[model samples]
Target: MLEVCVESVAGIGAAVAGGADRIELCAALAVGGLTPPLSLIRQAASAPIATHLLARPRDGNFRYGAGDAALVAQDITTAAEAGLAGVVIGASDASGRLDADMLAGWVAHARAAGQARGRPLSLTLHRAFDLCPDLFEALETAVHLGFDRILTSGGQPRAADALDTLAALVARADGRIIILPGSGIDTSNVAAILRTGAQEVHASCRSPLGEASEAEQRFGFQNGAALQTDPAKVSALKAMVRRA
Candidate 1:
């Protein structure tokens, strides 16, 4: 399935309309994604589809303290309570390695929340996986912890640029985990990424232009509010994935 990473409210509508198999709802895409507010998650999940939440507390780096980790675990419950389909979480040590122990707790928290709420609790190891001190070792750790997926660019800026490394990751994943290629994914490069043998791909799939609404115009007077819903690009990405 092709998953679109949604950065705004309008992006959510566009993804569903364009037939996105799933969505990763987040905020502050400019600094990577951060946890969206509970109200935002509620509005998005109310769409009656598989909308996942990325429980990132901030941008910048992934190294987190115990307090930060606890916040992440709490967010899993918060998102699941709001009816989100899953969550994307990543934690690392001071030296940039996957903190599997902490992730295990977060995963457990998500599963429990999902069960209590009657929702699915899938977990996507965020790009921090690419920063692990040892890629192969981190891959093993993720699988051992039963992570649902790992979102990576295969150790480069773009998935298409790191096809060779991603292939190795797919192999090393050993069917115990899913390798999801992201970062710089677009219609032009999605087919090629799928050819790399990864089952799923990620993309922001944005349009320079977007649709505006009346309410937005009223409150956005003189603001020149830009539309974040890029329906055309979402459809284009879906078409490209189908052909693949």
Candidate 2:
């Protein structure tokens, strides 16, 4: 399955049109993604593909505070109310270990929210797992916490770059939970990722934005370089995955 990471409504449209199996709805992909607006989550849930909302309240690090956890709970409730397929969530303590207590709370909140809607919501632990001190121990924790899936690059910046570790993690998972390899995945190397025995892969399928207008370039605080999902890229990736 191809899980396309989309930052905007345009990206959502492209992913759905291109046969993506699921959508990881987020914002500010350049900073490793953040929670998207409720309106975007609502719009994405209306689409045909399964939509998983990223629950990170902010960017920079996986270690979250008490207040951050509360915000995550709120987002989960909002996602459930919007009829989303699921939500992607993660948290860590200052020691870079999985915050089991916080994670359990968030999971319980997700479950309760889903029940209120009379449907179960899928739970995915995000790439924050990469920040854990021990990958094997963290995998066990995720399974214990009842996460249905985990999105990781095997602790590397790119899944292709961590083939050996990813394969090891997949073997270690042994069907207890899904190991979804992501980060820098594209048509060029998706076959290699699949060969690691991972059932799912993630990609942004982004194309570079065109040059900004002179006035906008002068006033805009953000770097002009931006990325958006390309439908053709997503389609080609799906075709390659099918062949694999």
Candidate 3:
């Protein structure tokens, strides 16, 4: 299965049209993604594909404060209300370890919220697992916390750059939980990535739309040109995954 990360409404349409198995709806992918607005969440959930909302309150570091934790909880609840299939969430401690307690609280809250709506929400530990001091330990922690999956790059910046670790993690996982390889994934390298025994993969499949207006750039509103999921890229990636 291919999980396409999309940041805008147009991206969502492209992902769906391109045959994405799932959509990880987020904003500011440049900053490693943040919680999208409630309106966008509702809009993405309306699509036919499964939608998983990123629950990070802000960008920067995965280590968050009490207020930030509160915000994450609220976003998970909001995703449940919006009828999302699931949410991508993660948090690390000061020592760069997976924050089990924090994750437990949010997962419980998300599950409870879903139960109230008569649907069970899926929980995916985001890439914060990549920042953990020990990937194996973190994986164990995630499993203990009842996460449905762990999105990681095997402690590397890109999955292709860490195929060995990714394979190791997959072996250790032993189907106990999904080890989703992401970051720097594309059709060119997805076949090799899938060869690592990853049942699912994630990619932005983004392409530069065009340069932002000079005025918009000058105002520091848009950094570079906008990026959107290229339907062709998505289609090609899906085809490659299916072939593998």
**Best-fitting candidate, measured by TM-score?**
3
User: Model 1: per-residue lDDT, tens digit, 36-152?
Assistant: 887788889787568888998877888888888888988888887777778899988877888878888887888789889876688889999888767888898888887889999
Which pairs of residues have clashing backbones in candidate 2?
A: none
Which residue runs of candidate 3 sit more than 4 Å off their true CA positions?
none
- Give all TM-scores, in the order shown: 0.90, 0.97, 0.98
Q: Candidates 1 and 2: which is better by TM-score? A: 2
Q: Which stretch of 10 consecutive residues in model 3 shows the poorest summed lDDT?
A: 56-65
lDDT of each: 0.84, 0.93, 0.93
Which pairs, if any, clash in model 1?
none
**Candidate 1 whole-model C-alpha lDDT, 0 to 1:** 0.84
Model 3: lDDT equals: 0.93
lDDT of 2: 0.93
